[model samples]
Target: MTFSIVARSADGRLHGVAVASKFLAAGALVPAAEAEVGAVATQAHVNLAYRSQGLALLRTGVAPADVVAGLTAADPGRDERQLGVVGSTGDGATWTGSFCHPWAGGQAGDGWAAQGNILVGPQVIDAMRDAWLDGSELPFPQRLLTALRAGDRAGGDRRGRQSAGLLVVRRRGGYAGTGDELVDLRVDDHPDPVTELGRLLDTHTMLFGKPDPATLYDLTGPLADEVAALLAAAGHPVGVAGLDGALASWAGVENLEERIVAGRLDPIVLEHLRRTAPPGRTGD
Candidate 1:
């Protein structure tokens, strides 16, 4: 009924999970991670305890394989559960219980695990594993979701798609650097949940992601003039001396405040303002 991948970033500072299932709101139950600790995906009979318990074990420096062993060995329903785990400093591990529906199993390697139950075929897990290996260049959250998408394309839950989720954690990576959650996106229900999940991730990145220093432009000269005009056209006009304040107000309204800088502008934010400015106006 589900497929998932759990992984740690190459530098070992990030950990995450991406999952999709015929079950509703799989995100709420199947995936868990802790920055600098590890990630876990528990499905099939879905032992919810495996999520927190697995992380606790990883926090103690337990190897992922041992975490799986310890968790399942102590459960009477272990034969009906499926699990995958990855620790901060070692290879990942996976387990498919004996009673899980057919076309179920998993694969694991350094820093990653892919697993599923009631899937279309082994190809689902295979595709997920291959994508995880091939996506080393992607951002951690994107890489995990890329693997989930591959499994979906290969034939995900045998029943069909209903929900999807992506979660990534890094130290001080949350909103305003206040928590460990870097990305926690969910498409609780969608006709094409994986695709919808991808779209939400893009929006999340735009609204919450850090601006690239390389792409920031000083708000002086023509660039500043263009922005000022754009703001005015959008009905937040300001005098020449108050450009910064006006830009901040406009960005707040547009929910682009995270990308705002004191005297510099992110190109992405500038483009968004241009695109959203009233049509027939010079800024537009």
Candidate 2:
């Protein structure tokens, strides 16, 4: 009752899994990834250990097909399990057990795999494969999301949807550059889970995505004064000399310092100021 894609980004800098299923918290059950390692999605009987073990195997330089072989080698119920993997080297492979629900199958290539069981039809995986091919230049997270959307468009789980998720990992892509959960989002139970997951991904990007340096707005003149007033109204008053300090403190508190910078602001940052400034006051 699920469909998923496991993929490595075109640049080989990230790995991701996108999945949707007629199961609660499908996100928690089906997808896993680690930076510089690979990604996996195990469904159709759902072997949770396959996630960690699969990554470990990928990290060991095992080929994606070999990882799938090793995962099913010792399993008593391998006939009921479905798995997909994309290795660090960008090779990919998939397995759909013989006993999985009807319309079950999989397709894989050098950098991606698409698999599903109990799907509406073969079109589900076909659409996902086409979508992944079409989104080669998009951010990995966006590409994965787009693949999920395409699967849904072509008729996804025949049973219906309860949850959807996207998991992407990159070196030092986490908040504050501390870890690698570049994009991890889920809609555990939504009438339109894919759409909802996309919304969460967008919000995550806004809150944490780096702005282009070319678009940064230096805080000076009227912009600085207006920002200072907003800070004061928000309970962080500082005179002109300390305006820069005040903005710094506020940005730290909101976790937007990456885009806000010190004295320079991103257009997103300025828009934030407009949204947070007092009702009757507008930024100049």
Candidate 3:
């Protein structure tokens, strides 16, 4: 009752998984990844151990196919479990257990794996694989989610959708470079979980994404005046000369500190300020 994609970025520094299932809180169980190691998706009978154990195996430089072999080889219930894995290098691997419900299988290539069990049909995995291949130029997280959305549109889980998740890991890529979780989002339960996941991903990008140097706007002229007005309306009054500290304070309160630059601003942060500028007070 699930579909998923596990992949490693072209440069081998990013690893991630995107999954959706008819099961409740599948996000809490089905997907796992470690920066510079690999990613895994375990569903159908759902062997939670496969997540950590698979990452450990990948950490040891095991090929993804061997990882799948070693994992299922040790489980007595292997025939009821489905698994997909992608390592930091070489081809990915996928397995569909014999006892899994009908219309179940998977596909794998150089850097990705797409799999599903009790899906509407093979088209789900087919669409996912095609999307992953065609999205080689997309940002890693967006590529994974794009593949997932393609599968959903192609007829996902036969039972329906309940939960969906996106997880991407990169070395020191977490918030403020303090962790490895670049994007970890879950829609535990929603009427349209995939779409909700996309919305949350956008919010994550805006709040936690790094500033593009080319898009940074120096605090000057009209932009500076507008920011000062917006800050004042938000109750954090500031003069042009004091924009830096005041903006930082406002950003911290709004949980946007990660997007703040010392003497410049990210357009995303500016858009957010205008969006939340108390309606008519925004000055259009």
TM-score of each: 0.97, 0.94, 0.96
lDDT per residue for candidate 2 within 59-100, as digits (tens), equals 889999999999999788899999999988856999999999
Which sections of candidate 2 miss by over 4 Å?
A: 282-284
What does candidate 1's lDDT look like per residue over 61-125, in tens digits?
A: 99999999999999999999999999998799999999999899999999999999999999999
Cα lDDT for residue 266, candidate 1: 93
Q: Over 4 Å off in model 3, which ranges?
A: 239-241, 279-284
Q: Root-mean-square deviation of each candidate, in angstroms?
A: 1.4, 1.7, 1.6
Better model by TM-score: candidate 2 vs candidate 3: 3
- lDDT, candidates in the order shown: 0.93, 0.89, 0.93
Off by over 4 Å in 1: 239-241, 282-284
Count of residue pairs whose backbone atoms collide, per candidate: 0, 0, 0
In model 2, what lDDT does residue 185 have? 87
Model 3, 71-126: lDDT tens digits are 99999999999999999999999999999998999999999999999999999999
Sliding window of 10 residues with minimal summed lDDT for model 3? 275-284
Backbone clashes in model 1: 0
